[model samples]
Target: MYAYTALGGPEVETFLDLPIPEPGPGQVLIRVRAAGVNPVDWKKRTGYRPAGAPVPEVPAVFGGEAAGVVERVGEGVTDLAPGDEVFGQTVTGGYAEYALLPAALTARRPPVVSFEDAATLPIAAATAHDALVQLDLPPGSTLLIIGAGGGVGVAAAQIARRHDLTVIGTASPAKKDFVESLEVVPVEYGEGVADRVRAAAPQGIDAILDLVGGDELETLAALLADRTKLVSAADRATVARLGGAPVERARTRAVLEQVAAWVADGLLNPRVVEVFTLAEARQALRRVEDGHARGKVVITVPA
Candidate 1:
């Protein structure tokens, strides 16, 4: 199995042939068709371990979500069998010819959804869906999404719109047209960004979904009347100090199923702006790490 591995840090990632991983109880072996590249994927390579998740061994495979054909199922996993088209959150990694996906977290891929689009759902779309659910604002309410040009932000904007929320998203000036195409009011991020948002939404932001952290998040925090409506998936400590909460992700097959349903129904589009072959996995990571990708970037594995 060929996959990209984290060679100690963000500065290094290499492709290698590793032994195919076997599925244990409650797991499934997937012949990966596509894998999604996300900010966390690079962050993990740089040593950012999610809370409560163990640090991976060195030269760890570098991906978080994938979509593919099931090659086999493990013990106690009776709901799925070989040849099922599925997409899900990965317990190990997705950047490979084959990988293990926990059966509980897996969702069936609808015939309407392609492998590339399904691949984007497990992490990026799932996180966006979870973030919107956490915000819990009613229809017609205003919600602001920071760093809205990236995968999660783009998905969040579309989901918010579908749920009838007025979306105001922040991104670099380069993404103005792209963001607007999703029906989100695009605000340029940087100095005085809060003022820009304020001017755009004179009624003030109802809820804020912060994807960019540091001083920018602090500035956006001021736009909200109720700090509890503020959520940050990027900076936990800063959001905590501001009396906001980080995204409480629901890593369940249910969430993936719902999200996939939306995608299947044309209610949500992942806007996968770029696709790369596994041989170009490093370049895919580079696009996300550089923060220049307009939407999701995916790596397609050879069959």
Candidate 2:
């Protein structure tokens, strides 16, 4: 087995002949076909976590989202068996040829979904679903999404639109066209982001989904008509201190199962901007850490 491990600092090393992980009780062993790279993946590698827990063992397999076929099942795992195609988020060990997933967080991949697309669903889509639904947004209400061109942003846009809300999203000039193609009104994110959103939505925004924190937090707060409706998945602590809602998903198998169905029905689509091989894992993490990816970046493992 070959896996990408974060040995600390900015280094990601590829280790050949890494030991294959075994399934524990209530877990399944998956032969990873594709792994999705997220901001959190790189952030964790760089020793970033809000909870401030001790780092996992050095050379920790660094991946959160993965899609693959089940190779074996552990004790008490009855819902899945060998050869079933599935995808989900793992606490660790997804960057390897084989990884273990608790049965509670794993779901069958939809028939119409590909490994690349299925790999992107677990984290971003589930987070978006949690944020929007938590706001209790009314149909036809106006909603604004900050950083709307990225993986989570695109998912939020489509999900909100599906609920009959007038969706407005912000993206860089380079990604404006791509954002607009998702049926969202794309505004350029910059000095006049609020003004641009106000121009498109005269009555003020009913809710805001803020993906980028920092200075944008103040700007997003200023645009909220109902402060309680402002939600952020990335900055839960800040959102709580600022009197806004903090969004989080349960990461359960049932929730991801619904997401898989959306992918199958063509109701949800994850944009894969780039794909790298296992050996190029460093470059994949670099792209995500630089914040240049228009969507998800995936690492494909050769069979």
Candidate 3:
């Protein structure tokens, strides 16, 4: 199997022919049909490891979420069997022809949902759903999202709108039109972001979800009356200091099932603006790493 994986740190990531990984206990292997490209895929190569992620064994594949048909199941995994169409976080890196997924974290992909769309739900859509559930705001309340043009932010904005919350999102000027299309009040992130957010939400923000952390998150924090509602997915330590916590991700199959259902029912769209073949995975990674993608970018693997 061919895998686009990290051969070394920084600039050494490349594609290579590798052995197909076997599923361990409570895991399943799938013939990857589509893998969602995310910023973390590239960041991991730069030595920015997320907590609990296994240390990269040379040639570590470059993706986390994937959608495909099950090929094999490990011991203790029974709910899913061979031929099941499923999507979830990968245990064997998703940027390959085949990958392993923890069975408990995987969910069936609805027939109405395409592999490209299902691939985006495991991480982006699931995080958005988790963030909103953490905020727990009611209808008619105003919710402000920082960095709303990226994959998770875009999902959060649309899902918030659907739940009857007035949504305001911040993104680059280039994404203003696209952000507005999601029915979110678009605020350009820049020198005067605070002013723009204040102007957009005169009723005061009921809660805030921050995807772009750092000084920008600090700037937005000042505008909120209740700091407790502030949630950050980027800088956990910083958010903790600001009296806010990181987005408590559910990371469960049930969450994936819910988001997949939303996509299948047309209630939520991952808005996959770009699709690349596995051979073109570099271009796909570049698009997300360069912060140029307005929505989700996916890499498709052929049967």
Q: Specify the highest-TM-score model's number.
A: 1
Worst 10 residues of 2 by lDDT: 1-10
Model 2 stretches with alpha carbons more than 4 Å out:
1-9, 12-16, 52-54
Query: Which pairs, if any, clash in model 3?
Result: none
Models ranked on TM-score: 1, 3, 2
Q: Please, what are the lDDT tens digits per residue for candidate 3 over residues 111-166?
A: 99999999999889999999999999989999999999999998999899988999
Q: What are the lDDT figures for the candidates, one per model?
A: 0.90, 0.82, 0.90
Q: Which lDDT value does model 2 have at 120?
A: 87
Model 3: per-residue Cα lDDT at residue 31: 97
Considering every candidate listed, which one attains the maximal lDDT? Answer: 1
TM-score of 3: 0.96
Q: Write the per-residue lDDT of candidate 1 for residues 37-118, one digit (tens) a residue.
A: 9998888777777667787777778889999999999999999999999999887689889989999999999999999999
Tell me how far the alpha carbon of residue 258 in candidate 1 is from the true structure, in angstroms, after superposition.
Answer: 0.9
Return whichever of 1 and 3 wins on TM-score. Answer: 1
Worst 10 residues of 1 by lDDT: 1-10
Residue-wise C-alpha lDDT for candidate 2, range 255-295, written one tens digit per residue = 89887788788888888889998888878878877878887
